[model samples]
Every structure is written in C-alpha cells, then in structure tokens.
Target chain A: MRYDIRFSGSGGQGIITAGILLAQAAAIKAGKNAVQSQSYGPEARGGASKAEVIISDDEINYPKIISPDIVISLTQEAYNKYAVDLKDEAVIIVDNTLVHEYKQDGHKVYAVPITASVKELLGSAVSANIATLGVVNEICKIMEHQWLLDVVISNFPERAAENNTKAYNLGIDLAKKVME
Target chain B: MEKKRERKFLQGNDAVALGALYAGCKFYAGYPITPSTEVAERLAAWLPKNGGRFIQMEDEISAMAAVIGASLAGKKSLTATSGPGMSLKLENLGYGYMAEVPCVVLNVMRGGPSTGTPTGPGQADIMQARWGTHGDHPCIALTPSTVYEQFSQTVRAFNLAEKYRMPVIILSDEIIGHMREAIEVPLEGELEVIEREKPACAIDEYKPYDNSVLVPKMASFGQGYRYHVTGLNHDEYGFPTNSAKLIGLQEERLIKKVEENYDDIVQVEHFMCEDAEHIIFAFGSSARASKDAVLNLRKKGVKAGLLKPLTIWPFPDREISEYASKVKDITVVELSVGQSVREVSRAAGGRCNIKHIYKVDSKPISPVDIEKAVEG
Candidate 1:
C-alpha cells in the first residue's frame, strides 16, 4: 500500500528536510521508490513549509498530497492548518510545547513534548527538529532507528552532530512509550 | 546498399513527436489538452521508457516554465498544445524568445479565439503565431501541409530553434493533426539534424549573448559555464539594461538572424502555376481543397493554381509577392473569416485582384467553395 507522509512547520524548522531524509531512506537506502515535493511561499524564512513524501513499490502517478496517512506538525500553525485534511485513519502527531491544546475529533493524537525534550537532552531547543525526526521514525516504523541515526549523522555537519544524536535518541525513547 | 525509403500513414502530432525524439529530444514538459493530448500522452509513455523524462505540470504556464528550466539544464525540450493551452503558454514563450532559449512549441491548432471547436481544425492561428506574444521579438513558424511534411518540418523546426536559439512553432491544424496517413520515419543518422553551436572561444573570452556570430554560443546550466539570463533587453553579458541602442541592436539582431537566414527557414509548395491566370493562397487542411479546386478550375478552363504554405511565418512574403504578381486574380481561402488573406493582400500589392473566401463555422474549406470564389 502507498503511504503519504507530510511534515509541516515553519520554514526554519527543517520539516522539509525531515521529509527529504525519509524519502531518501525509502528510495536510496531500502531500494523502494519515493517522491518528495515541498511547498514554500516567496518568503525566505519564517513562512509555512510543507513537504509531502509518497512511498510506494510501484510507479507513482499522482504526486500531490490528497490525504496523508501520517501528518506531523511541529507547530500550532501547521497542526491547525492541516489537521482537517488528514484521513479518518490518520495519526496526528503534534509537539506539545508548540501546540498546547489543539486536537482533532476522530483522529488519534500522539503528543510529544518535542521542544522541552530537545532542550533538556541537547541543551538547546534548536535540535527540536532532529528530535521530531526520531519521533516520526518510531511512530511510522518505516525505517529502523539505527538507520535514521546514521541518516542524521551523515546529514548534519561535524560540529553539530553530537547534540542532534542526543536529541534524536531522547525522541525515539519518548515516542516508543507514547505510541504504546 | 539498402534502398532509401519514404512512405506515409501517420497522424501529424505523432509525426512531430517522432521527429523530435529522432532529433535527440530528451525532455518534454506539457499539460494534456484536447487535440494535442495525444502528443503529450505519447511522449509521456515513450520518453521515460527511452531514458528521457516527461512532466505534466499543473498548467500550461508551468509546463512551459518547466520546459525552459529543463532546456537550461541542457536537455533538448519541447511542448505541444492546442488553442487555449497555447494562449496560456504565450507569456513563457515570450520569456523563451527574449532569453533566446532553443526549444520547439507545437501548436496543433483547433478552431478558436477561445475554446471554439475542440475536435475540428482551423488555420486561424496564423496571425497569432506571428504576433501573439507581446513585444517585437522574432518568431519562426512552420506550417506542414501533409503528414510527411509534418515529420520533416518538425525536424526543421528543431534545427531552426537550435540554430537561431529561439522557440520555433510548428503550427499543425486539426486536419493534419487528426488525419492518419502512412509515413516512413527515416533511420537515425539519415536526416540532417543541426544542434546549437557551442562557444568556440576560451572561457574568459566568451560572452554568452555575443553578437559577433549573430548566433550566440549557449552553455547549459550544469556545464560549469556561468551565464546570466533574464527576459529583459540586455547586452552581450545577458544583464538587464534599458539602453535604447542596446534594445535597438538586440531587436535588429533577433530579426536579422531569422530574416538573413530565411532561405534556410522558409518553405512553400507550388502546384500548376506555370502561365496560370488565377491563384488560390492556402495552408494547412484548406490547401487540400485548394489543390482540388485548382484541378476543377483547370477543367473549367479557368487556368487556376494553388500556392500552399509549408512555412507559415516569415510569411513567404517575397516568394508570395513574386508568384502572386504574375497572376491576374488571387483568392485566399482559410478556415478563418480572413487572417492570412491580409498577408496575401500585402503580397499581391494591389497589382492583382485579391478575394477572401472564408469559413468560420469550424468546418474544413471545401473545394467547391474555392471554385466558387475563383468564378466570382
């Protein structure tokens, strides 16, 4: 079955980059086919950024995100903007720190204290994006945790690698228990 | 040695795609539209299987934009559309013309100023093909009268596009588009296909838009050759400028490239005009009726002949003038009320009487109409 995953947040959050890493893992690492497309307005930053990734074993015809199976929102702006478009069976994952009380009626919600966890683990909230990437991997089970960790190491430059690794592991451990 | 073969049964749109593929077109970007969708469908299925790429954009504007983008990435790109879609693509076509990007745009014209007749054909876009896009930029338009010419002229379209570094339009109407006829696609390396000339000078000495050769050298985007391109009037460096002299020189250079090379770009077909007293100016499917009309008029002792355009733009102005001046009466027939008739009138120059036999009911001009026009 084809699964469409979308990562939506403000432009600086690396939400689109998270989508790209997932697509690359599915397409290049696992030998499956994937297509990733992102939408950002004319603004350089601080605007909404959304990246849609579709993974399938067969050729993909339609690339647009109609109803994503997994919708991850790192901010309140993204959650409120895209929550209504989710599939009935979709799992809506939101950051508890950025999105305090927003919830959808029929969809299951997984609230992770992503910003607070990243700040406590990595000594900064800047690694919240990497922490969310780990949460996404744990919930989707599309890629192994170790493979995602390797993806993070290879993706980030040398100086910031340790902080990202610490934040990512903390997110994976938190999502493991929260999803249960 | 094997036999040299040329036969015919193919639709004009398919022939155009075949010609483009044979000319090494590795990329095609287009949105599907009626009467022209087959070209995109065929390319979408064929290009990817052949190691090329195909993209269907959200609209014709994006389709044309992606085509220009792909061309900048060093792929020989093309797009096909009918009337409404072609209208949507004009803005991008202007950008392509101003940037001097080499590409081909096939307009398989249907009846319209709007969505007139989706399935029926018309040669009405003749004027639009020349001046549809804004500004005084030069354009090369080829009108193929037969499916065989559709294949051959498509190759010519690519050659002219690459040679002049401009978007060349292959204007095939519904008649040629839908009409299926047998056509032999020559083997690869048989047809002469001319690619764009690359820079011969050293990197430091090269100017991407240099007027020295009248044909500037182009470097593809990924080729490490740095160049800037914008739709504004600019100097040799491809920077935007408002200088009148630069604008004037660039405009003249654009026209001179096509005008001076019209001998290589313009094509026409003449039938039984030797000592004929009357002539009918026609193109696209209308020319088919004009051909038979000439036969009928000859049977009636009218001494009439047909002048069919294979090269619609550059208008065959001088050739039409020389040929029409020899005839006493010339009747211009088209699916439109009267568009190409203006060109025929100007070419005839009042030295010969001009008559316009028009049909705007979205039907092909019948030979009887041409005969009636000549008799009147």
Candidate 2:
C-alpha cells in the first residue's frame, strides 16, 4: 500500500525541506520508492506553500498525495487551507502554538506546540519544521527515527546538528506525552 | 567495476549532468534557464573534478555554437536550455544537425511561446524539440519519465548522437528535471559509452562530409585533417557546394541514416497492452500519471493500457501504430494542448479513435484528466 503525506506551511518554514527529507529517507536510506512534489506562489516566503510526499513499496505512478493520509500543517494558513481535504481517518498534525482554531473534521488531530518547543529546545524558531520532523516521525512512523534524524540533520549545517537533535528528541517526547 | 555504485536522491537534472559525464562529455556550454539551470550547475561543479570543461555562455545561441565548436575540437560536448532558450538555440542546433556534429542538447521544458510560464510545467516543446530547427534534418531526442530513465536516456542521447554523427536532444520536462528521486548512480565505466568514429584512413583521404557512406567518419578539428564544416550544403570534403545532386544526396542521407535505423532508434514501453481496450499514448511526466490511470481503469474493468515513448523524436511510430490498430481507441495525454496528440493521430492513421487529454494552463495533466478522457 502507498502512504501519502503533505507537509504544509508558509514558505521558508522549511516545509519543503521536511518533505524532501521524508522522501529521501524513505527512498535512499530505507530502499523504497518515494516521490516528493510541491507548488507555491512566486513569493519568496509567507505564502501558502505546501509539499507533498508519496512513499510506496512499488513503483509510484501518480506522484501526488491523493487525499492526504497524513497532514502536517505548521502554520494557521496551512492548517485552515488543507485540513478540509484530509482522508476519512487521516492523521492531522499541527503546531498547536500556531494553528489555534481547527474543527474536528473526522481525521484524528494531533496538536503539538511545535514552534514553542523548538524555540525553547533549540533556541531558534526557524527549525520548527525540523522539530516536527520528529513529531511526524513519531505519529506516522513512516521511517525509523535514526534514518529520519540523519536525513533532517544532514540538510542542516554541521554546527547546528546537536541542537537539532535535542529539539527532535524533545518533539518525540512531547508527542508521547500528548498521546498519553 | 572497481568503483562501487553511489546511490543518492537526485533531481533528474543532476542525473543528466552526471550521465553526460559518464558518456565522456568533456565540454558543456550552456546558459542558465529555468528547469534546466541545475544541469549547468551540476556540470559546473562536477566537470572540473572530472577534468571536463563547463562554460556559461552569453546566451543559448552561443551555448549551442560553443557546444558544436567544442565537439568539433574532439571533445564530447553538450548544452542545456529550456523553451525560450531552446528557441534561441534552434538555429545553431540545426547547424549541428547539418554539419553532422555529435553533441547533446538538453531541453528541460517549461511553458512557452515567449516566456509563458517560468515556473510552470509544459510539454509544449514536444513538436518543437523535433521540428524547431527550420530545416528537414535527422535528430535524436529522448524523454525520461523517471530519474533513473533520465540518467539512462542522457547516456543514450550521447551514444546516439555519436553513432548517428548528428545532434541529439534530451527533451526532458520541468517535472522530471526538478523532481527529486532516489536513483542508484552507475559506477564509473559501468555504462557503455560510445564516442564518435574517428577516421581509419590516412589524413590525406579524410573527408568531413562523405556521402559515400551513411555516417561519414568525422575528423575532429586540429586532427591533422584539412577539411571544412559549414551550415551550407557541403560536398564530400565539407566545402560548401550548391550542386543540386550533392545537396539532395546529403539531405537524403542525413534522413536515411536515422530512418533506416528506425527500429533501433525508436523505443517505447507497453504496459499491459495485450488485452487493453483503451490505449493511452503519453511521454515524459504525463506518462507517469497515465500509467496510474491505466491501472485504475483496469481495476474498473476497462482494460486500459499505456504506450510510453522513451525515444520521442523518432516518434516510435511502429509500436504506436500496431497498438492503435488493435485498441478500441487511443487517448493522447500531454501537458500541452495537443502537440503530441497530432503526431499520434497521424501515426494511428485513422485506424482508431484518437482522443486528446491536454492541459495548457501550465498545470500538470493529472490522472483524473486522463481517466476522464478514457471514459469519454
């Protein structure tokens, strides 16, 4: 079976990077077929940007996320824009600190204060997408933690690897706490 | 292979550069154009390390000329550009075609007539890649629907160009060029690389345009062979000759060189066409979506199938013809508003109903669009 996921956020929130990481980790590191694609306005940032990733064991014919089985919305705009299109039992992930208003739309909603936690743990809000890399990994479990961590950290500078790791671990812990 | 294979998540453009490198492409002269700029970027970074040459030309015209010049000087050369740049490069491209210059021109397509959409995707260049150049000339163009195919087809492009002693176009689209996919990079020396045939005879007897044979043995510039290479119709020694008989022979030989090898040059992938009632004709990125639509239609008891052409310029007429005759109807899917559909209709020869599932707003032709066409 194919698993479709969308990671949505304002541009420069690293949503594209996260989607690339997921697809790369699944395809290159884990030896699967994966496709990641996105479309956004010509804006440099702050637009309703979104990245979609589809991973399957077999050849992926339709490379788009078909009725996203999992959605990761890092901004209010992203959440509001995409939440309505989730699959019947889709797992919806959102940054609780950013997406304040969300109607329970049949899909299970997992809210984490991703921005707040990333800022506290990593001392930077820019890496909030990296932190949610951990949250999405924990919630979706599409790839192993170590592979996903490697894929995410490798995209960043070598100097910031330790803080990103700490933030990711914190995200995993926060996800566990929310589940309980 | 002494070197181990390297696996990486790479865009198709990256693979195109690497593929040229594998095919012994020693020179790249290209302008930066969207969807295809990464090809120049990757070659810039990798070519120096591999002892190859990369030059950013002032424009696509010079880029195409530079590639031809470098190839004439005995280097495996290439240049890549997109739609508008391709339009600019066509004159020089036809020059290379006429001169029988072996080089690769990668056209990573985007919407265009005149800078239509910089960031959007389009297969509008399908016919352009084949007929953009003003004259009737034989050229090879290959399209890859996947990243792996991009690498393989890029290598094939260089091989065919050298083998045919003519220009080859790698007609990649924006979606394939920019999309990242995991591919196992072939080890150095793992793939078969074909270089141009150097003259076996003495330098005194070498002729740049020898219509005596199908593909004349080219003597690279400064190879101690005194010969002329020109865009004008040239005689056996490559001197410009307006002789009616000789010019006609040169033109016919150029076309014959490719047309005679039609079976070898034409390539297509037939997916579940044995019992297919509906055959969908597509190439490049559109074929990916069509493949899925075929599968879905099969599940719905439609017996749908896909005929994907990897070698697009030669048009794969034979395979398309055979299938079009048997299938109840044929649907041509493309990002452009009916460029390839016309070719499919012509190749089908009214044997079957030819439908077009075309998109021209620069949006990708989704499977639903193709599926709807099949249903209709």
Candidate 3:
C-alpha cells in the first residue's frame, strides 16, 4: 500500500517538519519506504509552503505526489491551493480555526479547530503541526500510534516535549470526536 | 567479516557530505546556494569535528579556487553549488582542469539560464557540466537518481577524481539534493577509497607533470618537491613552455588519460532492455520517473526500457549506440528545455528515431508524463 500525504501552510508554521516527522515514523520507526520533499517561495516566512511525503510498502519510484491521498491544510490559502485536484476519496484535515472556507467535494473533510485548541491547551499554537500529524494518523492509520509518538518526541527538546505530546493527543481526540 | 552498516533517513545533500567524509575528504570550500546549500551546511559542521577544514568562501570563484588550492596542498577537497554559482566557478574549474588539481565540484541544478527558479529542478546543466569551463578538456560527471546513489556515487566521484587527477562533477538536481529517504550508509572499509599516488622517485628526479606515465605522482607543496602549477600550457617540468610539441603533448595526455580509462570511468544502468523496442534515455531525477514508466509499460506489454547514465560526462556513447542498433525508437526525457537530447542524438547516430520530452517550467516530469508520451 502506498500513501501520498501533503502538508500545506505558511512558512514558519513547521508544516515541513510535520511531513518529515511522518516520513521518519514510516521509514525509521515502521521500517517502510518513505520519501519527504518540500517547496517554498524565496520568502523566509508568510509564503505558501508545502511538504509532501510518500509512504509505501513497495519501493517508491516517483518521489512527488501525483495525486494526494491525504492533505493537511493549516491555512485558507493553502487549502484553496492544494485541497483541490485530489482523489475523489481523498481525506482532508484542515485547521478549522484558520482555514475558514473549504469545498467538501465528496471527499472526507475533518474541519478541526487544530490551532485554536492547541493554543488554548498548551498556551501556544506552535505544536499545531504535531497535532495535525495526530489527526492524520487517527484518520489514515498510516503507521503505529506509538511509532509516530516516539518520532515526534525525538524531534523536540525536553522543555517543548510535554506540550507537543499534549498537542498530539489533543489532535487524536479532536479527530475521534469529529468522526463521531 | 562483513562490516556493520548504519541505516537512517538521510537527505541527498547530507548523504553527499557523509560520503565525502567516508572517502577521506578533509577540506570543503564553497559558497552556499539553494538546493545545494545543505551539502555545504553539513560539511561545515562535520569537517571541523573530523580534523578537516571548511570555509565559506566570499564567492563561488574563490570557493572553487580554494578547493583546488586545498587539494594541491594534499587534502581531499570539495565544493558544492547550484547553477548560478556553478557559472561563477567555471573559470577556476577550467584552471583545475589545466593544472590537474583533483577535487570534487557538485552542481545541484535548479531552473536556470539566470536564476530561473531558485528552488526548482532542472537538468539543463548536463551540457554545461561537459562544456561549461570551455577548452578541449575532458570531463567526468556523475548523476545520482536516488538518495542512496547520492551517497554511493559521491564516494565514487571522489574516488574517480583522486584516481584520474581531474575536477569531477556530481550533477544533482534540486529534487535529489533535498529529497529525504532511508539509506544504509556504507561502513568504513566497505567502499574502496582511492588516495592520490605519492611520488616514488627521489626528490631530485621528481617531475610534477611527468608525462612518462598516464598520471604523475603528486607531491604536496610543503613536502619539499617544488613545482609550478599554472593554467598555461606547460612542459613536463611544470614550467610554461612555448614549445608547440610540448603544448601538444600536454593537451594529448590530459585528454588521453580519461579517454583510455573510459571503460573504468563510465557507468550506465540498463533496465528491461533485453527485448525492448523503445528505450527512454534519462538521468538524475528524470530517470526515477522513467523507471516508473518503464515498469508501467511492461505491465501493459509495451517493450519500453530505460537507460540511465550514472556517468554523464564521458557520455556513454558506446552503450547508447549498441542499444540504438536494436531499439526501434529512443525518447530522451529531461527536466530542461532540451539538453541531453542533443547528446542522445549524437550517440544514437541516426540509427533510430529520436524523440524528446522537455519541461522547463521548473516542474518535474512525472511518470504520467512519460507514460503519455510513450503510449501516444
């Protein structure tokens, strides 16, 4: 099975880091083939930035996503840009607090208050990328939950670890509640 | 006993730095550019920790000069840059060629003629890599299609440079340079690392440009064997010689060394070509998509195959000609407007029909793109 996932947001939002962490969980932790790549404008921040990950049981030949099976959009601009042209059954997880407008288009759309909830619970929305990963895993089950958690913890410093963990768990809970 | 290897998720640029370290690279001098900057970044942090030297030169020209200088000083040296920086380093790159300074110059290509797209991919540098420095000099360039090859081929690039005593180029695109994948980095002693041969003769008998042998033994500056290194045509004694015969001989030896060693220096990958009637000629990132297209074509019973040249410069003319003799058609796929297609036409020698799929919009050619071109 192959899963093509794209994370889109403004620069400095850690969208690229989220995609990398997902790929790391698949390749290093789950022992599967994975490739992660990103593209951003010249601007260091505020530009539309995107990171893509392809996870596969077989060897992945084409590194880029031909048609995304899953997309996580943290901004309305990103949503408007990437959330279209996806597979008919593609799953989309958008930050409801930030992405105010989106087209459902028969695809599974989980509009969760990702950034707002993280800010309310952890006093900062910096961990919203990690929370998005949690929501993605809950919806897609691309890898084991523990594998992703381990990979996420390894990426953060000791001080930020607890908050990121809380954000991740909060994402899973948000996805669970939305699915219900 | 088999050596233990470590597996980790590595970006292509990071892998190149690690491969250089594994191959005993001790010095890095480069002006960082997009797509290739990670290579310099990794080497900058790692080289000092490993008793090596790293310098962020004022510009690309100085960076190339510093690498040549470091290599002449008996250190395995390297520098990485993208298209624009590569253009700046060409003059010194030519100097390295004329002076026979062994160093690795990596060009992680981006869309270009003049800063076309700083963060996008392009293969237009294939020809630039061959003729970018000018003159009738021979070139050695390696193109890696995957992150693993980025590591292994970088080690090979250093090996080829040290063994051949020339400036070897690694032609990577933005995709391969930045893409991250899992790779098993070779343990030390697993991969053969070639160090330049030291002079075996007495100090008095030493000639830095000794043409008696295919490759002369090099002595470091401080090692007491003094010699003149210049871009000018020089005689066997390393001094500028106006003698026509000496200049002719000097040029002949430089070209002949690589030409005679073509078998050893050239590397190409042939996939499902045994009975293929149509072949896709590609390299670097385009080869990845072509491989997928070939597999997809095979499933549909189309006789499509892929010829990926790992060694881009010595241009696998002989191999392509052999395939062209039997193939009905050859389609050259690249991410540039059109670069490798010219080489493909020359190599095919009109034995078969040649088609090309070129994309210069700073976007990669997808597998679907290749499949559509082939199926149509």
Candidate 2, A155-176: lDDT as tens digits:
8889879888887888788788
The alpha-carbon interface RMSD of model 2 comes to 1.3
**Which runs of model 3 end up more than 4 angstroms from their true locations?**
B1-3
Among all candidates shown, the one with the greatest DockQ: 3
DockQ comparison, 1 vs 2, better candidate:
2
Off by over 4 Å in 1: A1-180, B1-8
Across A1-180, the per-residue lDDT of candidate 1 in tens digits comes to 678888888878888777767776676566566666565653557766677787888754234466789998888887777665778888888988888768656887899899888887667788887888889888878877777677777778998788888888888988998878
Candidate 2 residue B254 C-alpha distance from true site, Å: 1.6
lDDT per residue for candidate 3 within B1-376, as digits (tens), equals: 8666777898989999999999999999998889899999999899999999999989999999999999999999999999999999999999998999999999999997987799999999988899988899989999999999999899999999999899999999999999999998787788899999988778889988888888888888798888899999998878999999989888999999899999999999999988999999999889999999999999999999999999988999998999989999999999877888888899999999898998998889999889888877
Q: List the residue pairs that clash in candidate 2.
A: none
**In candidate 2, how many Å is residue B68 off?**
1.1
Ranking by TM-score: 3, 2, 1
Error of 1 at B187 (Å): 2.6
TM-score of chain A for each candidate? 0.92, 0.95, 0.97
Error of 3 at B16 (Å): 0.7
